[model samples]
Target chain A: MKTTNKIITNINQVSVDQVGIGDRVSRITARSVKNEAKIQGLKMALNMIDLTTLEGADTVNKVKQLCYKGMHLHDAYPDLPTVAAICVYPNFVGLAKEQLKGSGINVASVATAFPSGNSSLEVKITDTKMALDAGADEVDMVISRGKFHQGEYNYVFDEIAKIKETCGKNVRLKTILETGELGSLDNVRKASDIAMYAGSDFIKTSTGKISPAATLPVTLVMLEAIKDYYYETGIQIGMKPAGGISNSKLALHYLMLVKETLGDKWLTNQWFRFGASSLANDILMQLEKQRTGNYQSKDYFSKD
Target chain B: MYIGGKFPRTESGRYFTLKNAKGEEIANMCKGSRKDFRNAVVEARKAFEPWSNKTAYNRSQILYRIAEMLEGRKAQFIDELMQMGSTKKQADEEVFTSIDRLIYYAGWADKYQQISSSVNPVSGAFFNFTVLEPTGVVTAIAPEENGLIGLVSVIAPIIVSGNSCIVLASESKALCSVSFAEVINSSDVPGGVINILTGNAEELIPHFSTHMDVNSMLYCGDDKKSIQLIKENSAINLKRIVIKKDIDWMKDEAESPYFITKFTEVKTTWHPIEKIGASGSGY
Candidate 1:
C-alpha cells in the first residue's frame, strides 16, 4: 500500500505481532531501576509531567489550585523542579494562563471535542481556535475515532492537518489517538503514523478518559512509529501517555521506554511528557522518601 | 480470610487443622504466610487516613453497629466456640462479654479525646495544648485463649480511636475470629479497616514487626522468643511495640481508656496569645 502522493499514505504497512509486543513489554518492566539511577529516573519523570485536571465538575478554583501545585509541588522538598505543563479544558485555558504566569509552566488545553472527537470538523476547528486564542502554549486535539474506524484514513489525516493549521507555529499541536478505543496494537501503530504524517508535533496515546489508557505495549508501538517518522522526515515527534499512570514506578518505566526507543533526544520534557494529575504527587512522595530515609505518607503531601 | 476487604483463602493455599479435646480435627483454617501479612499491611496502610479522618461520632456509630451485628450473630459464635472445646456456659459468657466490650469502646470513641487532652500552664505568652491522634496502621496478635472475648478486646480499643489494624487470629482457637470478620463486613466497617488473618503467630509475626510501613505492633501472647524478635526487628523503624501476657480479657479490668490511649500519639501545638488590657488570662 505505497502512495505516489506527498501527503497521505497507507497505514497497513505498519504491522505488530500481539504476542511479541506483550513479551517485550514484560521484559522491559522486569528490568528494575534502583539506587542512584532510580532516584534520577524518578526526578526526571517528575519534571516531564503535564499535571492535568479535566473533569465536568471542574471549577475555576480547582484549576487555580492545580496551577499552584504545578509550580510548588511540595514545599518540604526544596530544590525540586516544577512540572512541564498544566492541562485543562479549553474554556479554562485563559484562567490557567493567568494563574501560571512567570512560572515557566506551559498551559495545555484539550480541544477538538476531546476524548470523543465526535463533533463535526467545523466544530473541531473552532475548538482548536478557541484554545489557541486564549494563550494556550499547547493544544491537545483528539482524532475522529469514528472516521478512522469507518476506513476514512483520508478524512482523519485531513482533519489533523486542518487542526495543525489552526494551531499555527507558536502553539505546539498534540494529536491524541485515544488508543484504548482503537481495539488492537496494530491499529495504535497505524493511528500514530497517521497523526505524525498529517503534521503533529506530538502523538499522544490516550485522552485519560478511557480504560487501558496507556499500556507499555501501546506506548511502545507509538514510540516506534515516532522513531520511524523521524528517520523518514528528519522530524522528531513527542509522546505523552496519559491515564492509569498514578504511581512513580510506572512513570519510570515510561522514561526508560522513551530513552531506549527514541534515544537521548526525547529524554527531556520538550519531546516527552506525562499527561497525568496524580503522578506528580506520587513522584514527590518518592523523592521525599529518598531524602528522609523513610517512607512518606500522602498526609504529608499536598492534594492537587 | 479478610485480606483486602473481601474474604479469600490464603494465597499460599495452605491450611492448618484444629483439633478438639479428643484430638479430632474439627476445622481447617488458613495458615497465612509472609505474603498474606504483607498484603494485609498494605491494605491497612491504604485504609488508615480515610478511617482516621472520620469524625469521632461517625466512628462511634460504626463501632456500635459492629456490636449490634455481633449480638445478632451470638448463636453462631457460641456454637463455634463450643466446637473449639468451650463449655456451653463459657461460650455464652464469652459471647456476652464481647458484645458489652464493643459497647464499652463505642462510648469511649468520642469521649477519649476529652479525657486525654489538656491545656498546659506555660510561662510565656503562648497558648499550648496537646491533643491525641491515631497512630496510623497497627498490627495485633490475638490471644490463643478466650478466642471470642480476647479478639474483641484487642480490636475494639485500636479501632475506637480511628487507627486501622491487621489482626493475626489464634492458631489453636481460630474459628471465632473469621466469624467476627463477617460481623465486621456487614456492619458498615470499611474494607481493609480491620483485616483478620488465621495463621500461626510464629510464622507471621516477623513480617509484621519488620515491615517498614507498619507504625505500631501489638502482641498479646506469652511467647518470649517471639516478643524478643518483635522488639529486635522493630528497632529498624522504631515502631511502637506493646507486648501483653497473662491478662484475662474477659475480666472487667481489661477494658479501659488507657488501652485506647495506648494506640494514639499526643500532638502538641503552640499558638501565640496577645496580651489584652493587662488582665491575667486563664485558658
Candidate 2:
C-alpha cells in the first residue's frame, strides 16, 4: 500500500502558494486571543511542552534537573500539570528515564546523528536502538538533508521508514526536516509529505540548531500537509515547533493555527509539543503573573 | 544607540532636535519611545546576570574605562554642555566633576562589599554573615540641573555596584547624554550595561516605575506629583524607589560608597557549625 513511487506521486501534486501563506499567517497572528481564552491557552501550552535540553554540554545532573522540572513546573502554582515529556540527547535517555520514572512524563531521545543526518543507515538504527534500550518513549530522528537536496526523495522516504520500523509500534518516530536548511516553503511542503508517507509519527520543524527554526508560515505549511495526509489516509500526526519559541504569546498563536487548520482533536500533548528549554519557565512565569496579578521575576523560578 | 550590543537608532524612527540657548537647532537625537525603553530593558535584563556575576574588580575596570573615555572626549563634552546654556566655566567644571565622580565610584566598586557587609554574632552553633548583592535592573531619571555631572552621579553608583540601568536624560539638555552614550559605547562597558534615552520624563517615568521587569527606580528630580505616581504604581511589584532631591551632584559628600549601597541587597547566610553536645570536653 505504501511505496516510494506513490509518495512521489502524491508530493508532486502538492504545491504551496508562498504569497498566500504569508498573508494568511499575518491575518491569523493579528487575531488577538484575550482574557479567559488566554489563560486556558497558557495552561494548555504549559501541559504540551517537551521541556527539552539537547546541548552538547548536557550532563547527568542537568538531565536529572530537567526531568524534575518537567514533573514539578512551578510548585508555587498548585494543580499545574507536569510537561508531557523530557527531550534530551540519546546518551542521557537512560538518566532521564531513571529520574522521570513513574512520573508519567515520556522521555524523548534525538537520534540519527541528531540535528544532522549525515551518518550511515546502520549507525542511525543503532543510535535509535540505544535510545530504545534506555527506555525512550519517543525517538526524534533527522532525515539526510544532503540526500533530500540531491532530489533523492526515495532515499529520504526509505530512511524515515527504516527508523520508524526500528522504533517499533510502541515508540513514536518524530522526523526532523530541519526546515531552515530546506530553503523555500515548497521544499518544506515536499519534505513534509515525504516524511509523513514514509511513516513518521510526528513531523518536526527544526533540530533547534539552525536559525529560523520555527515560524508561523512554515508551521502552517506543515499543518496543511498533515491535513491533506489525514484526509487521504485517515491517519493523524503530531507537530512540534522547536527552538526560539520562548514566550507564551507566540505559543498561543501556534495553538490557534493548529485549532483552525487541524481542528480540536490535535490540540493535546499527544499531538502537539514544544521542543524548548527556556519556554517552560516563561510559560510558568506568565501563569504565575495571571494568578497573582503582577509581573514575575526570573529569580523566583528554578532553572532547568 | 546600544540596543543589545551595536549602536542602533530608536526603533520608532522618531528624532527630536536639541536646540542651543540661542534657539538654533543643535542636533537631532533619538526621541525614544516606550518601545525603545522596552527594548533597552530587555537588553538590560539580559545583561544583568553576567554583569552582576562579574568580579567586582572587572566592574571597577570597566567603570574606570568609561572615565578614561570621557576624559579623552572632555572637549566635546564641554562644547555640548555650553551649547545647552552652560557657561564655559560651568561646562568645564561639570565635565571635570563627572570624570572625577566616575573615578570615585570606580574606586568604590570593588571595595563597597567589604565596607558594607558584616558578620553577625549568633547565639547558636551557626556562622552567620550578611553580604551585599546587586539589585538586578535599575532605572533612573537624570537631574535637570548639571546635565553631564547629574547624569554621571545618578548612573555611576547604580552600575558600579553591578546593577544595569536605563536612564532618562534631561528633557531640555539631552545632547550631552547622547555624547556620553558614545563615550560609554567606546569604553569596555558591555552593551545594555547603561542605556540612555532622551525624552520627556513625564511621558516615560510611569513606564520607568511600573515596568514589571524593572527592579528599582532612582528619581533624581523632586517633582512631587511624579514621585507620588511612582510610589503608587511601583507597588505592583514592590519595586525599590530611591528618591534623591535637592542635593547638588558637584558636592564632595555625593561621592560616598554609601551611594553604591543604595542599589544593593543585604543577603544574610547561616552556615551550620559543628554542634557541641551537652557533655562537656572535661566529661
Candidate 1 residues B1-283, lDDT tens each?
8876899899899999988878999888989987787778778988988999899999999999999999999999999999899999999999999999999999999999998999998888888899999998999998888788988999999998989999998888998888899999999999999999999888888788876788899999888899999999788778899888889888988899999999999999998887723697544
Expressed as tens digits, the lDDT of each residue in A1-304 for candidate 2 is 3567987877677679999999989988888777788889999998999989988788889888888899989888999999999999889998999999899999999999987889999999999999999999999999999998898899999999999999999999999999999999989999999999999999999999999899999999999999989998999999998888999889999999999999999999999998888988888887876787555677778987
- Residue B157, candidate 2: Cα error in Å is 2.7
Number of clashes in every candidate structure? 0, 0
Per-residue lDDT value at B47 in model 1: 91
In order, the interface RMSDs are: 4.4, 3.0
TM-score of each: 0.71, 0.77
**Candidate 2 lDDT tens digits, B1-283:** 4566656788779888888999999888888887788778889999898899899999999989999999999999999899999999989999999999999999988888887898899888777999999998999998887678988998899999889999988878888887888889998888888988887889888788877889999998889999999999889888899998989788886678888898999899998767645755321
How much is the lDDT of residue A99 in candidate 2? 93
Candidate 1 residues lying further than 4 Å off, grouped into runs, are A1-9, B6-42, B45-150, B160-163, B168-190, B196-246, B256-283
Model 1, span A185-282: residue lDDT tens: 88898888888888899999899898989889999999988888899989989999998899888998888888888899999999999999889888
Model 1, residue A96: what's the lDDT? 97
**In model 2, how large is the Cα lDDT of residue A8?**
88
